[model samples]
Target chain A: MKLTKLLATGAVALGLATGAWAQDKTKVGFVYVGPVGDGGWTYEHDKGRQAVEKEFGDKVETVFVESVPEGPDAERVMTQMALDGADLIFTTSFGYMDPTINVAKKFPDVKFEHATGYKTAPNVSVYSARFYEGRAVQGHIAGKMTESNIVGYIGSYPIPEVVRGINSAFIHARKANPDVQFKIVWAYTWFDPAKEADAAKVLIEQGADVILQHTDSTAPQAAAQDAGNVITFGQASDMSEYKPKPRVSSIIDNWAPYYIARTQAVMDGTWESTSTWDGIREGMVEIGEITDAVPADVKEEAVALMNSIANGEYHPFTGPLKKQDGSDWLAEGETADDGTLAGMNFYVEGLEGEIPQ
Target chain B: MDLSAINPVLLVASLMVAATPILLAGIGELVVEKSGVLNLGVEGMMITGAICGFAVTVETGSPALGFVAAAVGGALLSLLFAVLTQVALANQVASGLALTLFGLGLSALMGQGYVGIKPPSTPKLDIPVLSDLPVVGRILFGHDLVLYLGIALVAAVWATLKYTRAGLILRAVGENHDAAHALGYKVIRIRTLAILFGGACAGLGGAYISLVRVPQWTEGMTAGVGWIALALVVFASWKPWRVLLGAYLFGGVTVVQLNLQAAGVAIPVEYLAMSPYLVTILVLVILSADKSRAPASLGRSFHAAH
Candidate 1:
């Protein structure tokens, strides 16, 4: 009877230990450039993380740290997260690319995904939306709606991302209306509402009735709303509350689907490093609800354009184009490939200002 | 020269506005250091000001009132350090460093809501005739009220130190607090007041960053401007006028590099970007070459009982 009791106790202990070991949660971490509650970049990213929680339930766990500047501090935080047993990490900023790559090298088992960056390692993947596609649609709308024919562009930096957006917008705008002109202001930062608003004011004073921004803030929309009769697009997220006053249409960054898919892959053990520059076709970049403020005919045209792009039946960057220097850019029936678009440094022919060195 | 691309006049104006926060912080620090008080917590004081100014502005909807609140908030934070160093007779350097760390964490917590929201427009002053002049007109005359205030502060501080009896008493206390105490000048009180004033000025500078310069409360928006201000006090050798020159010079370097980039100058962005910091360090090395001019009792702790 004593031997039987000892054997039964031993079996119970072994079963409990195995069960506890199997219950280990897979930890996922995120780093953001802005606070999670900002209702913008970091907010959208956090929403995606929450979506993962909803989808996975108890299969995984999520954690985040906000307002981390892109520098040596980024590396430290990333390493800390990895040390804390994060199975996967997402760094959301272009400046975080190298740091993410560096950390990925140290912990080869950890999966890293860097946003808006090109560099990739064996354990790292790069992901960014086709933001310029949305710019093209915004450009078309601005080109049609503006009575002033002067469009103001609030650019964060002269980096290729912003510059490409400017060119893409200009290309489509000038295509629609030859007389349309753009006044550009370089705020040289991703987020600064004061500078962004000031730049918008300068452009408005200079007679721009339609404004677009590459910066990450609603200041441009606020400034446009305050000015009255001015129109601006929602950047990074749908800002419908300010509709008609400022936001008419927005380029919504839908990360939930991607987040869910990625997390599911991690659960299924099918996760592989890949660079994804998804757009309307992949449903990563979405054009938000077009408001009634836009003319019915223009709205119809915009929707059709969006549908066609989403169906891959039309490309915003279709060419018969030339560079600002009058060099042949694309031949007839040619569209700009991703390779050419990735390193776009020159402006389109109609753009008046020179690219900043 | 692409005049339209790189408008020299507008460039100068922007530089003055951009430099305002640093200028305000730097000048205030210079005064504090001149009084023989070493408050390296300008960054902390500035961030405290930023959060306070932003919060008040959001609550009251009046930026002007917010700025006043910011100054008070900054001075109050400084009082914490003053007590530690003055009453407790702690090490000023360590206490100042602690203040900075505390300020940064506190501001981050306080600035949670004001992150993406835009503040009210900062009023700009347009001098009638001067603003209309070619070249120099736009550079000097057309700016916000703070630019002129910054300039006036340098002159006011210089005159006070050079010509006023109050300045002499303050200087005497700074030079030898032991002697000043023996002479019945109330050394601790004067130093405390000077420290408070410095804290207020630094706070205003910080508020300028959130309220005017960046026009948004960002985490670490001051971006080492406070440290640069601390360095400037040394670079200026505790002189008010030189502080002005240093602020403008550093401001000019920043403006010029930006202008060069806008003008499509062939230099790499990273090199031009790093120039301001590099030059500031070089200037400090040159200025401190004659170490005889430095404050006699800088970073010294005072104990009345001892």
Candidate 2:
């Protein structure tokens, strides 16, 4: 009788232990296009995920899978994570659009967040930053600093996001200095350092004193450092580590506030499907401190422009622009609307080349 | 098209750099096949070279030393295939495929630390007056040393095969191993040396990619370059100069497509991106259709005991 009673207690204790542990934490999952320590795009997103953990302490549990290619593989990973009880999942990449939608359709209970994608289901939401706003600032700096009147742009692909950045930078730079021209080199990839560096070298040889890139690597900055006196900006993260040399300023994507707010919404039971596109005005996009590379007057002008943009007192893209083919694009004092910016597939007049069809 | 926008110099220079990895791997495979060894582990060995090259470059801050490490890594991995096929007398085709699979997985693990770090820059050899000439300067005189070495290797291999007595013996062994064995040439030893040389070249190619082409380490960075290199050996009809021609031709397609996009040609980005691979396939199909050009002992295995 005593042995039977002891056995029943041990079984009961084991069941309670599992139940308690499962109930103690809320599970969150993240899938990335690159390794978490890339010190660039995925690195910044991982930082935000870490912020969520710190804020909630023991209340939340998180898991991540890195270097997950976007396609059927992504669908499998998402489905598996949901089946394993991921309350919320973030699939980060433009290519993850269909996968996120497909997974959300199957798992209605799981919340899905996709970066730079447009597909949406009842349980899914898409989000992207106003990266063009940062480009506007870089354009202003490039316009003033360029003695050769030439700027180089390393483009990854002719996607809307990359096209939008090129146009925005051109719009603002031409506004500051009418003589400024853009020399573009398409590397045809999101991250290929050799190609990107070679493109930069070609541009530098072509007399471009300032360089910009839409690809996700610091190759441009490294190339700029080697070229001496050339200027470059950081993409996706604050790469101030290479500061006081090639990196004059950086466009820092602040995803922490959004991540914290979204997780809290999940906890408070008020989570709803919505698209959030925030910029410097909403503290979602941040500009790193200008280094000693810039002249004091230029720095002051840039800060003034930043304040105006934040306060809604000025617009960088307020227009008087022409297409590369010398066609009228925007009327005087008229800014491009969201629709035009979203589908921007043409190069403006100041850019010497065309955006291929 | 704007010839002015082409920058003939940079185009030629880029082509040379791009061709080196392919050339090294292809020429190595050519030697292996000439000696009646079929090794598909070229891809695996190339990847091993990539990771090993990147890791050493990161540690030592020297791209040259990294290339050396890459060769060593590639050779070591190739030995796995050698022992399996030579000692165990395993099927050569299956052993080669296994080597590729193992190489890919091992490189991914080894490359964890090198995921995003920028590798050390390769040094440029500016050929004084030649580099200053308008069109020729950028193309011929402005390439890194690897480009020149790759060209010289092609010539050296060509001369050895065409003129040297050792070349005659290697050819004799590959053509009729049993007859060569009776005449006192160690067929196994010769074939093994050729296999190791192929591995070293593959490693050099892999290193050239990590140290020059992409200049960073990522999972699957070679991205079928090894396979393309293998295909080129067949496309070249086992000739050294033809291998160079095939490599540059493929490299030209790659460079041209990118140029088209940059110059704002009216092609969809996806199609433009896939064009090079498509053309490569078409070229292979056309070349392979002419079976008369293929080697007699292309995939034959020789066993002394048998």
Candidate 3:
């Protein structure tokens, strides 16, 4: 009887405290798949969270749990955050798609946002940056710079996101230099520095003078630096510390503006379930500075390509493409629809190796 | 498949560097187990060491001091495990798992500022004539000091375990801690010291990864390597030389599989990705036919009054 009385009082006190706080400020929570210090994907996401804090100073309270694993644990974390009076939650990473939706169902009034995922619920929204647009420019640079005609790519996973990047990069590279060949080594992970470095070394040893990676980490940049003449592009962030030599340029994911807009929408009661895919024009995916290592003409061409893509003058996957088996994909002047790009699995023409189920 | 593109000398050199970290951790755990304690906190100690080494190296611009600090950091973290299991008579398994969790969290906290900061590079030992001996020289002499130290430690461990009086006492303690206690040997003291040594070794292994291998600090950079080292100790049948051999075998498979992928081998990429673990399991299965034994009193908490 005493334990029950204490529990009842404790529950009442907690509810009253949270209810009072909720009236004044909205509580927002973020779940990151990697440490906020990862200097890549999670780091950029955390920066967006910081932007939210700066934008909504006294109107909102923000909290984040880092390095939360995907699957059941993610669902559990989301449930706990919702129970703790979080008005909105952002679960970053593709693996959190299902968990975000599941949690959204239980907390119908609470809003949920997921990054790099396709799933959505009545109370959940999905958002991803068009990283392939940036990959096209990197491919053009790699094609122009490769002396061996061999460019290496390090893939994190065989998911559509990575496959789209490969296809986009390959298409533009072949356009710039018909002799260019791509050798891809799949590390099957988002971030393992040793493995990433080893992949870079093996590519260098195999005569790939230009390297690209979808994996987060600057190990490949370091590897390219050690190999002297080899060139690399930073993935997901401006790993510009190795500039003027190895890391000549990079694709930076800019999520701050989107994060602020969504937070504002939630506060204004205008938030709705929607899937958004924004590119360079909206300032979601940014291309980092092209260092002097890139030739003047190649740099100019890359800049022009970026401007064209941003201004809706060019489509990376516009026709004249074939599947690896040499079957027609997009005819000349024909562009790939978002449906095919969203579920991209096959390699384009001239690319070898399976996607790995 | 373009096999000619793969350089034999570079592959051997790269594998050596790849195997050193695990080999160091495995040999250390072998000693800890030999002293009748199973410290499952190798992963935690390793990440702690990685961050400590990276931070110290970045701050002091000295890779050598960074390694020393890594050893100290690892040993200090393992001391927590020692206190819980040795002094408090806590459950070894539970305490060890807790230690790993604590270490990972603590290291991440410590590593928050050190991320993306490159550490001082450890220079390779240039041994004049030997380093210029064509392919052999490049494979043997063109490596940093840690690679050589790892091989030397393996040889030293084998010699000590096989020939020294201290090794006999350690073996005795592991076989029957109560009997060794009855014989007036300080069983707790010996085990504690062994645990600290094991921690230092694991730390060095982690430092090797951060300071030389990848040469930068990243969260969870050890990335299940500690677990691999633990499995390696068991796979080696608690023998130091076998641990070295196993590390090399696993490392060789990892390097070769990457090479195969780069060469565009017809095999599926998934199969190639899992080849290292698969080959390790295959070798372990083949070796287990000999019925290797573990130390009898391993993982048992020693209480003098009991």
Candidate 4:
């Protein structure tokens, strides 16, 4: 009899709690692919999440589940948040695309935003930043600084986003220094530090003085620092802690403005399914200060390149570009379309070796 | 493929550094499994040690003291396992899995402050002229004291297991705990000590990564390496020297595959990614197929009343 009474009281309290959540607070949920303390990719996404909280104050309630593996498990996290009265959910990782769509179908009223992904539904939105624009600036500096003419690239995965960075960097690198070469190593992980350090060491041993990574860790920067001469560019967040040498420059991914705007839309009932891909011009992709490690002229050129891309005066993918097989991709003075760049699988011309299938 | 770009001497040097953590963890697990206590919490213990070591190093500004604290922290956590499995006679597997979950959460909470903060480097073994020789210097002397300690730990474990009376007694207990108990050997006390030792070694391995290898602290930075050490012990047929070799070979495959990819080698990326596990297992599988096998009383709980 006592157990039955306790159960009835517990049910009433739970109902009232959830009832309070629905009546006033706009609950926003975030699912991260790596730990929020990763100091790189997930770190920036978490900063965006925090911005949402700061923007709305008591009007919004924010919750997040970090280190979520990108598979069927992601669907479970999204489903739980939706059932718990999450008005909007942001699944932050390319791998979460399908899982986001699957969970959105079940909770049609729950708006879902998936980052760095392509799939979308009436209830699901897809968003990404043009990080290749920053990569172009990195390549320009790398080509100018590398005494060995060999720049190493540590790629997280062979997805379009990563492959696109490789191509964009290589294209500008070749233009900067005709003899420049790129050595690409795919790590197959987004967040393993030991593996990333090993990959950086391997590239350094093979004579790459300039290292640009798409992986989310400071291990590569540490490895480069230990090597004493190598220079690296930070990914996702400004890893300025290693500044003045190893981390000469960085690509800072700013998602706060977008996250704030989207959450505001949910509160105002103006939320709609959308595909948003913003970059330098939109302040989604930013270039961190080019440090003294880069030559003055090279740094100046990099800044100029960044400003041109930001102001619509130049496109990083401006043509006379060719595919890896020597076939023409873009005609002279022609720029790449968003569709081709989004699904980029083949490397641009003059890039050695094949993109691993 | 530009094979010329692949420098073999430096590869040998980096592979050893890469293999050190697993080597330490594998040798420790070998001793634990030899005592018939299967603690599957090596992963949990390792990450805990990583944070403990990192946090201590950052606070005290001494990597050496940090390593000691890590070992103590890991052993302290493992003492919980020792109590549950030895004193209470609880299920070893379930307790170990629970310990891992507990350790991961515990370490994350502990390491909240240490994230992105680089630990003070472990002081190098400056062997004067020996460290100046070109290829030989790099492969031999281009490392800190902890790395040499990892290799030395393997050798000491091998000598102790083969030559010491304590090893024989530990083996006897593992083979038949009931008979050993009748012979006046305290099975519970022996396992608790062995569990502590296993926990300490796992801690040292975790510290090697956090202080020397990656040399930075991040939540979950151990990254499934403890589980790799667990498999390595079984693959080495519970032998110490073979654990050292197996770790190097495993570590070598990973470093080499990355080099191959960077050199633009034409091998499929998927195959190269899986090659480390395949090569390690292929060689160790052949070695483990002989008469040498697991202990007679492995994973079976021992209670005097039973």
**What does DockQ give for each predicted structure?**
0.12, 0.17, 0.62, 0.70
Which candidate achieves the best lDDT against the true structure? Answer: 4
**Candidate 1 stretches greater than 4 Å from native:** A1-23, A35-39, A53-60, A69-71, A145-160, A181-211, A218-232, A239-248, A288-300, A352-357, B1-16, B88-98, B113-149, B176-187, B213-224, B249-292
> Could you give candidate 3's per-residue lDDT for residues A195-299 as a string of tens digits?
888899999989999999998777787777777899998788888677767889999998889888888988899999899999999999999999998999999
Model 1, B159-231: lDDT tens digits are 9989999999889888988888898888788888888988888898898877776566666666577888888
TM-scores for all candidates?
0.82, 0.82, 0.95, 0.95
Worst 10 residues of 1 chain B by lDDT: B1-10
Give the alpha carbon lDDT tens digit for every residue of B1-306 in model 4: 899999998899888888988988888888888999999999899888888888999999999999999899889989999999998888899888988888888998998877767678888877889998899998889888778888999888888888998888899888999999999999999989999988988898888888888878877788889999999998898989889989999999999999999999999988999999999999998887886888888899998986
Ranking by DockQ: 4, 3, 2, 1
User: Of the candidates numbered 2 and 4, which has the greater lDDT value?
Assistant: 4
Q: Taking the tens digit of each residue's C-alpha lDDT, what string does model 2 give over B73-188? A: 99899888888877667788989999998998899889887765678888887877888888777777777777788888889888887799888777777777888888889987
What lDDT is obtained when candidate 3 is compared to the true structure?
Answer: 0.89
lDDT of 2 by residue, A1-357 (tens): 675699999977875664466455777889887656455677778898999999998888777887677689999999977876777888887778899998899999889998877677789988888888888889999999999988888887677888889988988898889999787777776665555666776677667899988876666777677678899988888777568768899888888888888888888878889887787899878998889899999889889888888888866667687887889988898877777776678888757655756
Off by over 4 Å in 3: A1-24
Candidate 2 achieves a global lDDT of 0.80
Backbone clash pairs for candidate 4 read none
Q: Which parts of model 2 are misplaced by more than 4 Å?
A: A1-25, A35-39, A50-63, A226-229, A267-269, A319-340, A346-353, B1-5, B32-44, B54-62, B80-142, B158-195, B213-224, B257-275, B278-306
Instruction: Report every candidate's CA lDDT.
Output: 0.79, 0.80, 0.89, 0.90
Model 2 chain A worst lDDT window (10 residues): A15-24
